[model samples]
Target chain A: ELKVEQNPLFLSMQEGKNYTIYCNYSTTSDRLYWYRQDPGKSLESLFVLLSNGAVKQEGRLMASLDTKARLSTLHITAAVHDLSATYFCAVNTGGSNYKLTFGKGTLLTVNP
Target chain B: DAGITQSPRHKVTETGTPVTLRCHQTENHRYMYWYRQDPGHGLRLIHYSYGVKDTDKGEVSDGYSVSRSKTEDFLLTLESATSSQTSVYFCAISESSGAPHEQYFGPGTRLTVT
Candidate 1:
């Protein structure tokens, strides 16, 4: 079974501060995804990291994948109130099934 | 915004009643999936369909059943609603089982069992 673990499940940070959410997975897989969900809303895709050393950045959010270590990270460069949302990292178990195992998610609250 | 929509945006039902949630997609994706999200469990797949009439179980498929009669519709049925079955159900669609393709999620249906 593929397992995904995320750190600091609940994070409280001040606006303009920087933080990073870590996602570690068990088993070997190359496809990783980052998603963000606001309260009572659907998830929005943030980044898709396809290989080792692949990094994607949008606005203040940056996501990187290290397939050898079975780890992925979502880095927040400068937090803002609008960035307060729950972020999730998912791993695709490569095969014909293409099932995804997702981390529990990191709930971030940015305070001004 | 992948042209996927889940019906019954919010539903409140009594225990022991059967509830069916509908997921319709316009993207013509080859794979459709049903997932439930709870407080601490994140998102756990309930079922998935690879093609019309081709369905399979997921990690949490005990109380749920799914059917795909057409390429655009996937239905998730809760045989008997229970308090434990109450959660936000999300339907996702993917173009293929291949790598580097991301799944697109629907608006979600919030089901509450009383």
Candidate 2:
């Protein structure tokens, strides 16, 4: 069974501060994904890290993947109120079926 | 929004009642998945379909059933609704099983069992 673990499940940060959320998986997988969900809303795809050392950045959020370490990270640079949302990291076990195992997710609250 | 939609956005039902949720996609994706999200469990897949009429169970498949009669529709059925089964169900569609293609989620169906 594949297990994904994320650190700091609940995060509270002040505006203009920086923080990083970590995601670690148990199995060997090359594809990793990051998603964001606001309260009572659907999930939005943020990034797809296809291989080791792959990194993607959008606005104030950045995500990176290290397949060898079975780890992925979502880094927040200079947080803002708009960045307050629950972030999730998922791993796709390579195969024809393509199922994703997701982490518990980190709920971020940015104080202005 | 890959043209995905879930029916019965919010439903409140009594325990032991049979409930079915519908998921429709216009993107013509080959794969569809059903997942439930809870407070601490994140998103756990209940079932998935690789093609029309081809379905498989996921990590949390007990007490839940799914069927895909056509290419665009997937249905999730709860044989007997229970209070513990009350959750936010999400439907996702994917074009392929490779890189450069990611699953797109629907608006989700919030089911409450009383």
What's model 2's overall lDDT? 0.94
Model 1 pairs whose backbones collide: none
Error of 1 at B7 (Å): 0.8
TM-score of chain B of 1: 0.97
Runs in model 1 lying further than 4 Å from the true structure: B97-99
Candidates' lDDT values, in order? 0.92, 0.94
**Window of ten residues with lowest summed lDDT in model 1 chain A:** A92-101
Candidate 2 ranges with C-alpha deviation above 4 Å? none
> Which tens-of-lDDT digit does each residue in B1-114 have in candidate 1?
699999989999999999999999999999999999999999999999989999998999999999999999999999999999989999999986465678899999999999
Tens-place lDDT digits, model 1, residues A2-111: 79999989999999999999999999886899999999999999999988999999999999999999889899987999999999999887456678888999999999
User: What lDDT tens digits, residue by residue, belong to model 2 across residues A19-105?
Assistant: 999999999876889999999999999999988999999999999998889989999999999999999999886367878999999
Which RMSD values do the candidates have, in order? 1.1, 1.0
Q: Distance (Å) between predicted and true CA of B8, model 2? A: 0.4
